[model samples]
Target: MIMMTVLCIILGYLLGSIPFALVIGKLFYKTDIRQYGSGNLGGTNAGRVLGKKAGISVIVLDVLKVVLAAGLASLVSEPAAIWTSLACCIGHCYPIFAHFKGGKAVTTMFGFLISTSIFIFQEFSYFLVPLFMFLIILYLFKYVSLGSICASVCSSLYITAQLLSLDVNNLFIILASWLMTLLVIYRHNANIKRIQEGTENKVSWL
Candidate 1:
């Protein structure tokens, strides 16, 4: 069991460390995404550095990182699968291949949460509700971080509610949800401070 868990995590991390944004930037534009706007190898910065198309493509690829990880883990153990997925998210945030520098965890986190919520719980509402809320928040406020934070909180609340209603002691998932929430918020700390100072970058894609 322990060996499987460790292998799953390693596999997830390797998959997560692909650095698609960086690759895209270098291969097509002859630029380093990390040296561009926001200096982040993330979807938002990919848009800012390359274009909306690049950003969208990068997000799609980034999401696949977690999806692949989860799929691999699901073949081994159900519980290990979630942890492996999260490990992938973390890998995207701090990739070993990239000298531990990577994108914020939001995109990867959403990928895992959405995929798992739908497949495991047989409920698209759990993922869609928060996603709709995220879009609304982003459109109204123009702050991606703000929208992400709010949506993450809502997702956690909804998951907790679902577990409670089903009378399933899914403590691992409950804890995982909250932990992911906090991790995302923490990662957006700079954005939060900028928002407080009225200097946060308003996303232009919306």
Candidate 2:
């Protein structure tokens, strides 16, 4: 059991560290995406540096990696699934394949939320609510960073509310959700500072 859990963790990290933006950029665009825009190996930076198609492609790939990680871990144990998802998020933020420089963990965190909603809670609302919140905020603010941060906040709070309403205590799920929320916020510290300074980059199109 322990060995399986450890293997799941390693697998989750490796999967999360795939660095799709780097792959797409270097393969087709003949550029290193990390060298442009915010230097973030994320979909937003990929879109800004490459194109909308590339950005959407990177996000879809990144999200699938997390889903795959969690799904594989579920074969071992449910707790392993949750922990592996967390490891995936950590790997996304500081991917070894990307020289320890990586994305802000927004999309990876959403992937985590989606997996947990499917496997653990079986509650789609937990995933859908925050996704809608993210899109709405992005539409209003035109800042991906702002939308991501706010969506993380929304996810944590909504998860907490759901936890409080449930008779069964899901301590691990609650803790994991909050941890990912904090990670998303921490990863966006620079963007938060920029937003405060009124210099944060905003998406050019709605």
Candidate 3:
């Protein structure tokens, strides 16, 4: 078990650190995505600096990293798997290769939630209702930071409610989820301030 857990952590971290946004940006645009637009190697920055296509590609790749890490970890042990998923999310948020700076891990968390098998469709539906709603709101308001924060909070709430009602055995998952949510929120502190001052960046279409 110990060996499996260690292996999962290492594998997940390495996988999560691929830095797809940087890669795609450099490959197609001949520039480092981190050099522009909020200076974040994330989908939002990718979209702003690169293009919508590059942004979507970055989002898919980031989410896939979480899914791959979590799924591989599950093969070891349930607890290890959950921890591995969280580790991957951490890696995405603060990639060591990128001077410990990275994206907010919003899409990565969504991937983890969707990949977990413990919850059935009903539970997932309850979770997704708020998630999708917030996404819509974000799109309408052009406040990606607010949307990401609200979605993370809603996900944590949904999981906590599931723990209370369904008696699911994995408190680690809930705890990890909350921790990641907090981390994401912390990374967005600047955005929060901009939002309060009504100086936050909005979508170009808006």
Top-lDDT structure, candidate number: 2
Candidate achieving the largest TM-score: 2
Residue-pair clashes per candidate: 0, 0, 0
Q: Whole-model lDDT for model 3 versus the true structure?
A: 0.78
**Superposed Cα RMSD, model 2:** 1.7
Question: How many clashing pairs in candidate 3?
Answer: 0
Clashing pairs in 2: none
Residues 1-206 of candidate 3: C-alpha lDDT, one tens digit per residue: 89889989888887777788998988889999787888888888888988888888998999888778877777777777767877888888888878878887767777666655342232566457557966786877889888888888887787677665533445776787788789779989999999999999987722
Q: Which ten residues in a row have the lowest lDDT in candidate 2?
A: 164-173
**Reference-based TM-score, model 1:** 0.94
After superposition, which runs of candidate 2 have C-alpha atoms over 4 Å from their true positions?
A: 165-169
lDDT by residue for model 2 over 46-157, one digit each (tens)? Answer: 9889988999999999999999999999888888898899899899999999898999997898899889888778889999989999999999888899898888889889
RMSD of 3: 2.4
lDDT agreement with native, every candidate: 0.82, 0.89, 0.78
2 or 3: which has the higher lDDT?
A: 2
lDDT of 2: 0.89
Please give the ranking of all candidate structures by TM-score, highest first, separated by commas: 2, 1, 3
